[model samples]
Target: MSSPSREAILASASRLFGDRGYRSVTVRDIASDAGVSAALVMKLFGSKEKLFAAAQPDERLLGELNVPREEIGAALAFRVLMRREREMQEPWAMLPFTVQDSPDPEATRAEAREKYLGHIAALIGDTTPNRRHAAVVVSLMIGFGEAVRTLGLFDDWDFDEVVAHYGALVQAQIDACPVA
Candidate 1:
């Protein structure tokens, strides 16, 4: 089992990395934020690069890809909304930090983008027309997720209302593409 200090270091690393991108955060910063010694972090994660690998967004949430087509829209909307609610809930919060020209390694960014796209494709299934709609769904979810978390544009709306509206939007995208 991991020690509390280790968990704390990781949590701090995730938060810092998510906020500042990979190359910008330091082991010392994570150590200080976790109230631990820098040596401990180095000992635990070896190098800053390794620590970042550990801090990369957990993709297990994609397991929901098994949801039926009828439920995928709501499931995805709910998942994105929940991710916005807490940094630990979804790795989506760190997406902006891992984009092109960012400090994140190219492989890491490509892997993340591919994985998310795969999840969308799985949700939308194998239909040729649905493939394009899957891209739209991915874009909408990312835009809406960012808006709710970073833009404050939806601060006035109730949470359930937001989910409903967003879910409807997602469903509309899905509905627009008929399955062959």
Candidate 2:
């Protein structure tokens, strides 16, 4: 098992990176937040760049995609907007900041696009040859994520109402996709 200090460093880095962006955050800042020395952080993760890469949001969000095709929209909406229990410093919440400050923002963005459009597309079970519907749904979810995470939109609506409405819209896109 990993040592507790390592976990603390990782958690601290995740929150700091998300809050301050990669360029804005220093190794010393991470170490201070984690209650360790900067040298220790470097020893554990090697460098700031590697630490940032490791801190990117995990694939667990895709777990929501395990739902039935018809429910994919709601599942995605709930995952993106309402589900905030992961951690106080959830990496996903800082995605926008990381994308802006990462050393290779384009590459990071591309990786995310591939995961959301490719992996998620497959998980949605779009058996048809064309993936336009899946792509649209993925794009919509990205937008909703940005809105909720960065813009603070739609925070007032009843939870169920938002889920139902947003899910219905996304489901419309899925319904448009051709079946195998």
* Best model per TM-score: 1
For residues 65-153, could you state the per-residue lDDT of candidate 2 as single tens digits?
56778887787777765455344443345656766787898997777666667765676656655567777887677677666666768
**Tens digits of lDDT, candidate 1, 21-115:** 67788889999999999999999999987887787667786664666677677877787777766645345556766664254557766776677
- Segments of candidate 2 deviating more than 4 angstroms: 86-100, 126-130
- TM-score of each model, in listed order: 0.86, 0.82
User: What's each prediction's clash count?
Assistant: 0, 0
Worst 10 residues of 2 by lDDT: 83-92
Per-model CA lDDT versus the true structure: 0.75, 0.75
User: What ranges in model 1 sit over 4 Å off?
Assistant: 86-89, 101-104, 126-130
Which residue pairs in candidate 1 collide? none
Judge candidate 2 at residue 137 and give its lDDT.
80
